[model samples]
Target: MKTYIYKIAALIVIATALHSCEDAIDLEPISDIGADGFYANADQVNLGIIGAYNSLQEKQFDEWVVTELRSDNTQLSFDNSQNANVPYRQLDQFVSNPLNEFTSSYWRASYKTIGLSNHVIEAIDVVEDATLAAQYEGEARFLRGHSLFNLVRLYGGVFIVTETVDASQARNLERKSIEEAYTVIIEDLEFAYNNLPDSYGSDQAGRATKWAAGLELGKALLTLGTSDSKVRAEIVLRDVVSSSGGRLLDNYEDVFDTNNEMNDEIFFAVRYQSGLVGLGAPFANLFSPRASENSVVFGGGDEFNVPTEGMESLYAANDPRAGVNFSTSWVDNVGNTNFERFISKYNSDFGNVDDAPNDWVISRYADAVLLLAETINENSGPTTEAVDLLNLVKNRANQPDAVATDVDTFFEFKLALEEERRKEFAFENHRWFDLVRNNRAVTVMNNHFATDFQYNDPDAPFFNTAPIQQFQTLLPIPQYEIDLNPSVAQNVGY
Candidate 1:
């Protein structure tokens, strides 16, 4: 996973703000005490970088923006009720809603981080050390790119702003075309890739590395090509050749283990300490069930996002990952060992504590490998090499090898691969995107949900029963963005 530096950046900002404001008589203007003035020394520059990293915390703005609203996972049931609190469940063609709290929080949080990244990037150039300046700049770019990628994927075409704007002006910012938005994202990743160090040492162990930028760039290219055939061939070639350094780990599950952040497979990750002073934890409380003894005493036990039956069935029977990813049967709060199923990969013995110290992986080598295989299959067909790569992941999951014989006949293999990804990466936020990319969402979801699935068939079965429309594939532009920016048009049918 790519190590995110924004968390560090956020901490620096808070510290700087506190120190600078300690004396009321120090009459320096706020703009005069800008990042350039503040980052004049190495220690200050380091703090600035740390502040950037701090922005990644859930409270600061990264979690809900990137993960909660994303399509990858859904909330589990609350007290045996089938419906979860996630509002988008209704938007997903399975339920109904007037926008739930999760969706609203996610939108607000994403734009907040975007604003923070813009502020940091605009101020960092004042540092005296050339190398330090480059590092901070690269970190800022990575954060901006990372945030924008989520925005585009979720909203389709989002406003692209490079500098901080007042609330009034921000509201008026127009949405860019998807192509235009991707162009900026590609550029930011490329800049970060060129300027970032190949590796971050002990002090910067979890910071973004060159490989993280490469992975994001490659994925962005893949997204672009998927939407535009004219750019497809070159983008795939570029991605495969440019990202050779990123290789899958020997084991699939190892990538998610708390101790695996330093593994070669990680490209970028959001760092969370067990009890860092300014740093906040997001996953620690969410993963543990209410009854677990280790659960955090205060805000723990919600288990808001639970894996669904469809997600569970995606794994082959007896696959090792099945047990690791979720627990169909576990000892309940009373030590009865109830056989209830819930997401287990994120479970930590820490119980309901808010700071269990598991870092969220944004990108991993396994995804790179699977992407390489899928790209090869899409562009040329299943080859010996592609099959070998595909099986490398499957074999790790302790499942049967893929039986795909030719590239043209690899659709089943692709389906299987998608299913494997759903199981392997459940709750990490990859499912909805996978369905969209493969164009299997409507059909697969209809069958899975037992509703009539049709793209635009008014007479289609379950038209009333299943309220899904094709346009639901792309989420509605947040109503806030529509209200703020007149140039920002809503998605079709919204």
Candidate 2:
């Protein structure tokens, strides 16, 4: 049997003690009590900020969870009608309602990180060093904005807490409108872009940079403008101009290699150090299958995410990215041979049956370039510049250049961009959001899956059976949260 280092009860006791002692301490009176105590100096601020990064390392945000939600993987189940197991590739059918623990964990983890970031931002003023204080605040803002952006996209409207709210008040908080939520996200990212340094020194590699903030802000603005009014469109375009420095890496395939984490294209990423205090499982082990002989035992489990045929078909034959992103076969170090459709993008070995030290990229220049191209095309019909940008991505993928003989209409350009995004970012936890934002999820699902897709069904034990609506685009407020907080209103269908 696999050994667990810490028992669940022991972990719970340690966590409770740490949080409980926060209110009772302050006898020495270093900084303000509670959250403020953690940010008294530069080192302290760095540690606190890193803690926020650690939140992303939770199992729920790991590669398994991300890949499972991608268009590539199918949720497998026993088929009662067929008397055998069948691959249920329909995401909407399984993703709805309060039963999805993956979605629930993501919702809770994002807010927890946000709460930690809120603490850091509030405490920055108490830091005595002016320059250091500004830097710390900028980093905190970036973390806060990034967390909220992910939360908003997944849940639509979420509780927007600027300051440290009482746990009690946190429960009673109301959901902000999508517009209002994006406004705050933009504001925080803008602050980060202005105050953060252009690059971190060698000592601080993997930390947030000004360009990182810009890329994130640009993406946030681009997403916000998609479904909103013309005013939001104008605002996002302006932000895009200021944020995109027009610097994209020449090679896209190298961006995923562990050696390239420090490449200019990588804006911000969560740095993982194996054997460090906060270090945990690496992503490669999570996506590599159990039956594969080439696999390593990190987190003591089989690779959980296997790419589907539909996802594999998106790539053209002989595309370089296909081999680099995943491996259908491989040979081990000792001359042993193996074969499987295993994810190799996050491959890293730490020489033990534990998580390896591999960083997860949050924002990258390649994504920025593609997103800018998409945004420009959406606002105006496909232009030569837009085509050039899109082609740059294709060229890196080792595909023939994309040529648009004629300028397509806005909607047509959008469809083309969606197809490009699906191919370029297949397993990066973006396809679902892309479909939802474009208002094409239902249409796409209906077209692709035919009679297999159903969402929001109360009659079925696994999901809510209610009819899908435009408003159902957002996920329901998690049931446990609503149960705990009486004031919390459920999303339309719950």
Candidate 3:
């Protein structure tokens, strides 16, 4: 994230051989000058790669509704009765069905990125420079694998479309088992780790590096939770910590400073530029308090992914990241003070309505470091090394560092780790996945319903009690996807 190379490239980047559609996963246009003809030259192939990265910009706006909003870490700030807020309400309450529009849009945007990556993968073969072609494919695979990882986690078994296909073929294709899906994901990341460079030149600042791919691969291996996979994950992630040339920025706020963007702490981020050629982030405008409207963002804020009171309290007294994460109060147009707080991470770069230059971070060094500690704990148990890794993040937040005994046992260490992550990455969209991957989603969310839903939560009083069973942990397959292809069965209990 150090260099900002793309001021012009953020201009609507079309993959030379791309056939993308943002409506559905398998609905890419069947006819186009496919990858081979249009991206026959090396320069065109690079453009196709850049286009895949550009596709990620579209998903940043909606990714959190399914991720953070679904978790207890964030909630809809108010109990409003509007139609557009209904999907968010359903998700926050754990009653969202497959037809939830927010998840549907998220699904479409994810697949658009995946589809674009696939086109770039196929087109890379036309480039004569073999090394460059492999690097390009590695970047494409990292993006595709990253998207597939999200799809598999959100919806159970999703269609594994690695290539362009006609509607007929896509309709007939069956969803892969979670195991089968991960097989493809791990393979792609493995290829990425081998081929991607440890670092890129200034010309390609934010492109996926070997360290980024390794962290993601280590995460996939850890998610598998097999003994062999955990061992591999530890090895992979250890290498990232020791050799990646990335470090946690000392000042917590400096990490997200709008003007001081370049730093080694970022491993990979969905890059955004704000000149309004269609590639800026919308978190500032969309997630700010609606009351702040023209006073804060030029247009009104939607109050999406607003902080929960429980989430706000996670920060310790004088914790460094608290101010950077969110703001507690706002004065609306009529000067009414409200508790409907907004996230401040993306607030610094607000350019206009729906346009902010803040990039959405997907992978960062601290995430990897914490994950490394998790891998070590799972692979072996709580060790000195693991405790050190856990304390690194805490120390950065000005919280007291943990001693060996505090996290001496596996269960204690796990809980401590989760709490630290919750505080460190509250609105960055890590809470739900952390719970699910560690097998606590069902229990934690049910507790949220019983306690928070019944008491102080703002939106809780609006809806009936929504307790989730085991099956509810996995979202119902998007109703639109099932509607498009009758063979695509919905997840059980839909």
Among the numbered candidates, top lDDT falls to 3
lDDT of 3 by residue, 1-494 (tens): 34554545523346333455533474462236555666667786677677667777767677888888888877775546545577788888778888888778777878777777787787776778889889999999998899999889988798887886665676577888999999999999999999999897776788899999999999999998889999999999999999999999998888777665546898888877676756677888878887677765667687777776676677876997888888887777787887656787887645577777788888888989999999999978999999999999998888888966779999999989998888877788889999999999988887776766433446545555566888887888887667767878889988
Q: Per-residue lDDT for 162-235 in model 2, tens only? A: 77766555556787888899889989988888888777566567667777887787777777765453334445
Which of the two candidates, 2 or 3, achieves a greater lDDT against the reference? Answer: 3
Question: Residue 439 error for model 2, in Å?
Answer: 1.7
- The alpha-carbon deviation from the true structure for residue 472 of candidate 2, after best TM-score superposition, in angstroms, is 5.3
1 or 3: which has the higher TM-score? 3
Off by over 4 Å in 2: 1-33, 59-92, 226-250, 276-278, 293-303, 329-340, 451-472
TM for every model, in the order presented, reads: 0.81, 0.80, 0.93
Q: After superposition, how far is residue 279 of candidate 2 from its true place, in Å?
A: 1.6
- The TM-score, computed over Cα atoms with residue i paired to residue i, of candidate 2 is 0.80
- Model 3: how large is the Cα RMSD against the reference? 2.5
Residue 112 Cα positional deviation in candidate 3, in Å, after optimal superposition: 1.9
Q: What clash pairs does model 3 have? A: 2-262
Which residue segments of model 3 deviate by more than 4 Å? 1-24, 27-31, 82-84, 331-339, 453-461
